[model samples]
Target: MKTKFSFLTLLFIVSSFVIAQDIQELKIDSKVNDVTVFLDGAQVTRKKTVDVPTGITNIVFVNLSPYIDSKSIQVKVKGKVMVQSVSQQRNYMNNQPDLAEAEKLHAEIFELRKQLKLAQTYLTITRKELDFLNDNRIISGRNNELSITNLKETSAFYGERLKALKLKEIKQEDDINQLEKKIQQLENQRNQLSDNRGFPTGEIVIKIESKTNSKSEFELSYLVTNAGWFPSYDIRAKNISEPVEILYKANVHQDTKVDWENVKIRFSSSDPNVSGVMPSLNPYYISYNYRPSNYGRIISEVSGFIYDNKGEPLPGASVSVEGTTIGTVADINGHYSLMLPAGSNRLKISFIGYSSKTVDANQPLINIALNESAQELGEVSFRDVEATSISDALQGRIAGLDISRSRNKKNIADKESIAVPFVQTENQTTVEFEISVPYSLKSDKKTYAVEMVDYSLPANYQYFCIPKVDKDAFLLANITDWSKYNFLEGEANIFFEETYIGKTILDVRNAGDTLQVSLGRDKNVVVQRELLKDKTSRQFIGTKKEVSRAWEINVKNNKSQKISMVILDQVPVSKNEEIEIEIKDLSGAKMNNDTGELKWEFELNPAKEKTFNLNYLVKYPKSRTLYIE
Candidate 1:
């Protein structure tokens, strides 16, 4: 504020501006520490050259802060050189705003203190009056009537006191509101005053100044278009970046004056070199190259299906691929095109809010149908069960043999329902099934038409189900019908493929241990006394010579325990002739070919009894070569 030219000096300056080109007045007001130039009010930029007339023009100045907008400032000066040489300093005391808010709050608190004083006085008087009534001194008129009069007086005092308290509270609230408004005003002021000081963002303001002979005119065509974005917001990891494309679905017009109909106009992103529009129908694919910078062209595609766990298709269910930029609403048929990648090698499919699933899509087609996971029931298969018996109790488990029959109620019926009969081996392993009548309809003494569809099955299992009837046709018809298998109750023995857990197995002899045994093509082996559901599953592809079918233990206390053992066997018939076992252990064991079992007892002081394992080779014709894949 030190430098100033008198009004008389300004008259001299006016005379000095003899030509219109002379700048008669020059002034500057700045909110930043230094200001050597001026920019457009909204632009916040410095122009290369600003034509000035021979006079003092009221050029407004502004402050700069990151959080504030520019505000106008006023100053007075007298010469071009003075204006050019002058650097105005600008400052804003941000802390002073809190001072304003504090002042308002202080005033509000003062008013509140006055109201609180009045309220306190009222409350004191009310309490004193209530105490007087409690002493019954305020009684009058009749007994009850006097009591009512005292209550009336007490209530009136209390009501007045409460109202006064409420009024004081309301005043406090008003004070808080005033403080809030003051704080808000301070914020607004700060925001209104901030600017970048001097920096350039990508926002461009093109003020078109046209000269029709000396008549200079200007117009603005503001464009806030993105300079770095490729416009395509859809990109999947599997998609390679090309010139990413975006479709402006909204209707676009040229200008306010005219409406263009069906104009096939194109819009460019940052660079005019890259541009695209919606493709016309039936055009050959044109190759578009992408210019790579820090950002890559984002692109995408999506495939999947929705289904319920019951093998039923869920219609119109939403399915999505996680982490994939591509998405599609499921079709009316409940199928979705998750054309995200060529395929998500690790395909994760999900419905709305349901648990998502990840499955490997290693097939030619990667469309996966999702099913809700289910909890299985507690039950098992009986054929997979070792028949309960004393012999069953002592059997270490059997390898394989012809048969030693056990007691079972075999019933004859009008129609013979065929089934495979199962028996346990010495190890308590439910192994073999003698298929005397591979398929037969039979009724038990109780008239129960029961039939075991499988001739053999696994030993250790957690759950099992079987068709009531053994007819293959009926079984196939009811495969998914839910009524085929009457699931037997009880934890299964052969519970897992190679290991069993979370399930109980009555492995009287640790038969619950997963038996991963490989059977030779024509070897007769007793697998399990009762099978899981399919005894054929107990069979395996042998990469090594099969375990010897027969094992023997010397009954000398170390080896023998004449434990009552029931053995089951299986013989792959290469010849039409019957297969028999040649035993060398204890003589008490009996063999029954019809049932494919061997059972007996031998005495052992841990000595006289001996245990043995048996194996046999099946002979076939030279021309009868079996081919297996």
Candidate 2:
């Protein structure tokens, strides 16, 4: 019985060894098939096909983004294969393709450095010769006697040599400076290219079991954090009678180190990085207030350039409001402008190879210079645990969740006229726009403009002027039913009458039923405000002082067409009980008593003008002085 048990144990051991050896490991490269970019992140899908052996096999997909979210990984296999497990890991052994331009720049910089060293050597030699000549001249003059003619000849020779050496020294110095400048420029270019490189590439390994030798296709997808898109718009109006043309665009950017070449791309309004958990309301309790400090000055928008310590522009640098996700990437010229959220006081600026900086956001223009990091970034590690097994019956259903394929296609009679061919998909929490054509995007962090769609909506054009603040009249376009357009708050470039006006912020988040877009200032529709000296008076009663003031505003429609205009004026609202204000005349204007704002709407024809007068009186105690204008 002992001998039989030993034989069974030996057989079992041999069987286990063979089974372990049967699992073959295969390394394959997968192509990026589709990418769905969100506002804060992106979902990348890769697909590959390989012949499966009639046993357990492990397929490893290589050259993926290092910033991938391991928990969001999903793998699906199609064929007679059962996916047993999936895992992600960082492969430090793999070498990514170097940037060709960057490599060229490196070589060029090396040559320039050699030239600079040679020039510096020449300058050093020239200076040494000058010093030696000076020493020899002093020694000869003091230690030896010579004729006048000889002395004159010796002095001439010495002076000529000194001048020649000095000129040579200056020339060499200039050459060295020029070479150093060239090297610096090349180094800057190379640094920009190698910003996010020198890191390990990511890999996804799937262990599957197959019943027979067959061919199978695999789809692997994961969420990456260093990719996103932002919206921008162009508002164009030809005239007051024509409909406004709104062109929507997306600025897509990525630094994932994986180039998306001719892949299907989609833009989603959802932000996967933000927590999706439903927020619960806590109990509201009233509390007594103590001292309330005045809030600092609120900044509406901030714009500036990002630079390195060497004063070179750092394109693709990130600029964001501290403690908030509101951010933007610097453009090719290193210029970035972001609208500040309410109560945002600080801005955080960062780049790949530079130390991040935080600056106060109180100023409209905040430029930051970042220093190079002294230490290398830590290695990114990923979890290697088994992924949730996807059943063969639900593989197709699960794949559909990442991207919702549209079945209904819109018929386009004139495809050539479409700026961008795309289909819009509405999801539960977000809207997606799938581009019909394939797009190729590089792994660089620079933003690429992707034109999405355009809409022509009927707009009511009105000229608005607050002469008390600004003398120029701004043209406003009010578009109703704007919610259907899926517009986000972003900067818009305004064009009126086929001329580029200026940029304005499209604050869709704070809009009502009608979206009012400012088309910048129109100098043709002029406005001016002046004080009426005749109606201004001051008097003093027994213990009270009273002052009366009047102002007149004129609006002119200098354009050839008639236009509607809205004029705004304001009266001072008294905050103290001892101070009293009364409106004497408003010239048929609607007044808001609480805010002390007056509004007048009227129509003016070509070369026509309209005038409105505002008169008010203020009464205050004689002991206190109140300034009014």
Q: Could you estimate the TM-score for every candidate?
A: 0.18, 0.79
Q: What lDDT would each prediction earn against the true structure?
A: 0.29, 0.79
Which candidate number would show the highest lDDT if scored against the true structure? Answer: 2
Task: Please provide, for model 2 over 22-129, each residue's C-alpha lDDT reduced to its tens digit, 9 standing for 90 to 100.
Answer: 989999988899888887678888878899988899898888887777777777667888887777788877654376776788789888888888888888889999
Error of 1 at 9 (Å): 45
Residue 384 lDDT, candidate 2, scale 0-100: 26
Q: Name the runs in model 1 displaced over 4 angstroms.
A: 1-147, 196-227, 230-629
lDDT of 1 at 609: 33
